[model samples]
Target: MLKLEDVVEMCRVPHDKKFRLKDHDPGWAGDEDVPKAKRKKFAETLLAESSAELAEAQDRLYAADTWSVLVILQAMDAAGKDGTIKHVMSGVNPQGCQVFSFKQPSTEELDHNFLWRYTKALPERGRIGIFNRSYYEEVLVVRVHPELAQAERIPDAKIEPSFWTDRFEDLNNLERHLSRNGTKVIKFFLNVSKKEQRKRFLKRLNDPTRHWKFSPSDISERGYWDDYMAAYEEAIAATSTKWAPWHVVPADHKWVARAIVAHTIAEAVEGLHSTYPEIGPEKLAAIEAARKQLEAEDSDPD
Candidate 1:
C-alpha cells in the first residue's frame, strides 16, 4: 500500500508565494523503486486501498453531518479530469456526492458576480462536492482571454495590472470563509505535458468514438498554452493557503493521477475525525422499544 504521506508529498503544492509550474514533472509516476513495467499494477493496488478508505470516511462524514468536502479539479483539455474523478470516486455513494461541471456561463450566470454561481452549488454538511472546473476559471481562462472578463460588463472592470491579483485575493477569502464554516476545500491541477496532450488530441481525432470529444476550440486554446501556464502558476501560488491547498498531480499516467487523488481525498476526510452521531438516552430507549415490538410481532403466530 502506498503511504498517504508519500502520495501527498509527491503531489501537494507548498504554501509558498514562489510556486513555479515548471518545477513539477507532469510525467512523474512515483518512487524510482517501482520499476516502470510494474508501476501500473502498483497504482491500481494503491487506488483500491485508498478507495476503500475513502468510502469508510465518507460514511462517517455522512453520519456525523458536521462537515462538507469540496474537491476542485483544474486541468488543460485531455488531461483526464473526468476519468480521474470517475475512478477515484467510484466507491462513494452518489447521494452523498455531487459533481458539477462548469462550462460556458449562461446569461443569468454572467449577470451575477463571478463567485455567485459557484457559491450556490456548494455541498451542504455531510456531502462531498466536486467542481470539475470552477471559479478558478475566472483567473485562468479569463486571464488568457481578457475579452471574456470585459463581456461580464462589470462597472469599471478594467484589465489593470492588479486585476488578476484582486481576483486571487477574492478566491483566497472565499476559501477561508468556507473553511471557517466546516467545508474542507481541496484543489488539484492535473499537470500534463504538452507532448502528451498533443498525442491525446491526435488520438481523439483519429478515433471515431472520441471524435465527439474533439472541438475546434480545444485546438485554438493550444495556441495560448504559455499564457495558461503563467496564469495557473500565479493563481495557484496566490491561493494555496493553510486552509486550502492545490495538488499538482502528474497526469501523463492516468492510473498514477487517480491513485494520488483518491489517497489525498481519503486523507482529508479522515483528518476530519468525524464519527457517527451519538444517540441520546431518549433515542436509545425509543430504539429499544421499537426493537422489542418488532421481536414480539415476529414471535406472534399472527
Candidate 2:
C-alpha cells in the first residue's frame, strides 16, 4: 500500500525537463496493485483526515499573518476543476480563503497586461487565493490560436519567434517575485483524458441541472485537443519553478483528485511551520490579569 505522501510525489512535475503532458497518466489515482474498491475507500478516509489538518493549518497561517498561499488550477473542459476546488477547500475558513474564476477577459482587462487582473486578485498575507483559470490562458489558449494573441496588442515585430518565450519569462518572473514576497504558489494541471471528458460532457447534457454547463463551443474546442495539450506542455515546462511548482493531477476520479489536492494544500501550509503569534511578557501579564478579574466577577454575577 503506497502512502498518500508517496502518491503526491508522483504527481509533481519534475523541475528538470520540458514537461510532456503525454508522460502523465490521467487515470492515476493510487496504488495500481490495490483493488479499485479499497483504493476508493482509502481515498475517502484520507481526504476527511486531511481536511481537518488543513483547517488547523489554515488557522495557524491566518494567525501568523506572515505568509500567503496561491493555488492555480488549469485543465481541459469537464476536467473537474470546480469539483476539486469545492471538495478539497471545503474545510477552509471562508474568511481566510478567496476564489476567482477567470473566463474571457473584459475590454478593460484586455487593455492592461495579461497579469494585471490576476495580480489584483492576489491573496493578502495570511490568506489562501485560488485562481480557477489564470494568466496561463494567455499562453495555452492563445498558443492554440495565435490569432487570439493579437488582442494583447503587441507590435507585430515584437510578436516574433520569441513571443511565447517572452510571455513564459514574464510568468516565471511574476511567480518568483511572489515567492520572494512571502506568497507561495502551487499550480495544478488537472490531466483529464479525452474519453473521460466526453463522458462528462454527455452526462452534463443528460442531466437537467447540469444543462447550463453544456455549450456548443465546448464541443467545438474539443477539435483542438492536440493543440491544447501541446500548449499545456510548453506552458508548464516554461513556467514551472521551485517556488511555484506544477502538480499534474490525475483528475479522472473525482474522489482521488480531491484527496490529492487537499493533501497537497494541507501539507504545503503545514510545512511552512506557521503558528499563532507568540505573546510578549506584557501581553501575557495582561492576559493573566484579565483572567483573574473575570474569575472574580463571573460566578457571583451568575
**Against the hidden reference, what TM-scores do the models get?**
0.95, 0.95
**Residues 1-302 of candidate 1: C-alpha lDDT, one tens digit per residue:** 35668768767877865788899899988677878768788789889998989989999999999999999999999999999989999999988999999988899999999998999999999999999999999999999999999988889878976998899999999999999999999999999999999999999999999999999999999999999999999899988898999999999989889988998899899999999999999999999999999987857577
Alpha carbon deviation, residue 200, candidate 1 (Å): 1.2
What are the Cα lDDT values of the candidates?
0.92, 0.89
- Candidate 2 structure quality by residue, lDDT tens digits, 177-280: 99999998999999999999999999999999999998898999999999999889888888878889899989999888888888898899898899899999
Which candidate wins on lDDT?
Answer: 1
Worst 10 residues of 2 by lDDT: 152-161
